[model samples]
Target: MASPGKLDTRGSDFARLARQITDAGLLDRRPFYYAIRMTIMAAVYLGGWALFIWLGDSWLQLLVAVALAVVFAQLGFLAHDLGHRQVFRTRRPSDIAGLIIGNLGIGLGWGWWTTKHNRHHANPNHEDHDPDVSPAVIVWSEDQVARSNGLPRFVAKYQAYWFFPLLTLEAWHLHIASVKALFKPEAKRRGPELTMLVTHFVLYFGLVFTILPVGKALLFLIVHQGLFGIYLGSTFAPNHKGMPILTAEDKLDFLRKQVLTSRNVRGGLFTDVALGQLNYQIEHHLFPNMPAPNLRRAQPIVERYCAEIGVDYLQTGLVESYGQALRHLHEVGAALRRPLPIQGA
Candidate 1:
């Protein structure tokens, strides 16, 4: 299929469906649900911190740290939902929530996430435009593999197999990236966000170092960061990793583009909470501003609409989705084995 980057969206039924969804108030905030959910997450996070502090130097401390990391990632998801104005009606409160959860809790810059995420939503799976898909240690497309070199090239050759193991470093990657982005001269105006991120690290490291010996602290940090990375990546990868990769030149309508490129993970309520309602990725992409809780309710409507129009709506189990995403990486990695074209031939 062609990339849907520049397609005409004016006449598409997706346009009409979007209007209907909006008119039906699906885009409205679900303050009560968010309030309760956030409260529960916050309590769990705080409880974990309390236990970690009280336990001091023990193997159980590592468990508490891992639990804290998971809770922190979920808080990040809440911040993401707030960024989309899913819980709050206005932007100010949402921004505040984003600051607290993203900067303070996760040590991620809210503005950085919002800017990058909005771009991804605007052009998800676009090889050139989506930061999420932009080549780093792992190349997701054949074109990217051809241009990669050195360590990256070596990794791309076996990226599908290495994907999960490599994610163990992603938590560290995010912290470093967030720090770099926030501390840049161009980002000085975002001092408040930067300050919160700094504060989070200071307190986080201080508590760890104070309670545990150097060796245990290091191990605790690694375990916390590793599990955190896996949790975050698992939530996001299944949404679009195995789907189509769009380029800047591809012309696709908004509806067709989002539906074709996004996949929904099939599961029950447990999966919904675990994935932060992102298991309904197609619904979330179609209505970016919709409350997370509402996505489940909107699923049947969106699915039926796609069916009537013969649009393929992708949905699969968690295991299959991960396998599919890995298969895609291997397929792209094939380009790395091909001989490079001679330049200036």
Candidate 2:
């Protein structure tokens, strides 16, 4: 069978989608946005931490701690913006705060992420070049990769085998020198790179040695990181994987891909609240600068644009999409020996 191709959105119609995004306007100051974003995360983190401390050894403590850890992941996403200087009015505060919040989670540095994440956005879905998208390591288009129907159908079945490990390892090696990692060459320096990971490592050990008993702190890291890992990892994969991989033949402008490359995760309201509203992945990618809170308002307009242009906009109740992601992982694992396609190289 032939590979599924892309949509044609270049004519007069997409001109309108482009205009709407432009009219949304850039935030006057991304740092100001970071300030507000960090404040909320701090509140969420501190509040959750207090609740966990109060819960003590009861099993409920685990639940509370788990909730706080999930918030930790959401805050990580905001800090991602700070790293890009997209969240703040100025770069300095964005870096300091992003450095702090990200410690609790992954601890990606501003200089490093600016080097890589921007490339991800600019070249999304290109097999060799777009680090953010798949390397074609696993071969399946969006529809082939996702579940067909019903809750029992998904929960009872598992499809992907690669997502969790990939999510865990994505930043594992950092930027290794190669045709790809060269885009973020600064990563070759180890000293500053390790400095960024210090905050969380300090917290984990500091809690273990000083704030709490060593046993308790160690347990907290294990349970918290595991739950937090699941929370962050699962929500993200379905957006890019399984979507048609982009090739050199494809010429995508930002607006076209804002529609093309992203998938909307389907889920209930609580899913929205917990996962940082990521179920609306397409809208988020399209207007990444817009506060995530606003994507609810943007969803309809984006949906309308996709329909008008004949783009295959994907939406799945995440309950199902989650399984789809797992299935994709398995598919990739099955093809582990194959060389991944590198975009633009």
Candidate 3:
């Protein structure tokens, strides 16, 4: 446990860093960048469906499915930015855009996802508080393994190997979770969210079934949804999956809590664009509202400050980040893999 004096110092650490970041204008919203980005995404989205229709009944439509999957994942990324308020200064505009992009554009529930995601940002890697690390189809820690039963227990011993394959269903999981969230008593804007979700599915399926034969439509749905899941899951898995998992006893200031448990992936512009600029996980965690385009500029300032404060900063190559996360998954399941002790040997 830290002394009271040390705790107070730690509390101010983030404030100092935040001041530096604000002075650099890194936290300012980039309306122009967002405008250009949203326009381009909209064009690509409409173009994708247009291509689908033009290629009607052809198996090459499978290729169109792949393209649209990428577009959907990209829309998901845009919605993420909206939820973070990176594109807008106020919650109203952000929420509105998030609803359009998340619900109407990609069949995700904006309110539900933002609520879940905000919790994740608030408590990244926290075993108890962060829903991202909570026990579900996959368990993140050994304690979760001990508490597990049924399907979760059945898969715990091999979760590392199952992780990527299971991501093929992540999109479906998200869609189901989104709909279920709307039924909760405290869900906000439930009527609008449900309406948009219904409209999205109706239009999405209606086009597919009407344009392609039933068999092709089914195949197209499977491919598109599967690829979208994999892409979105892969982008996020590298952020904090293998990082330190904190318990309730781990009392740290916001700076250390967010920084110590996040890992950054090293890359250039292409990686930045592909990962939706989330490659700067530490910076993103440190300043959740920072515009996506400004993260790259903020990286060096953050890295220097962390070093001056004697915090260990983690950054790895893209491939290595995934390897680290998968390795952690393997280690968490190790207890389950050990042979049962023989009685009365």
lDDT of each: 0.87, 0.59, 0.92
Q: Which stretches of candidate 1 lie over 4 Å from their true place?
A: 1-11, 185-189, 337-345
Candidate 3 Cα lDDT to native: 0.92
User: What order do you get sorting by lDDT, best first?
Assistant: 3, 1, 2
lDDT of each residue in 301-344, candidate 1, tens digit only? 88877876668999999999999999999988886667889999
Q: How displaced is residue 245 in candidate 1, in Å? A: 0.7
**TM-scores for candidates 1 onward, in order:** 0.92, 0.69, 0.96
| Candidates sorted by TM-score, best first | 3, 1, 2
Candidate 1, which ten residues in sequence have the lowest lDDT sum? 1-10
TM-score of 3: 0.96
**Who wins the lDDT comparison?**
3
Task: Output the lDDT of residue 52, model 1.
Answer: 89
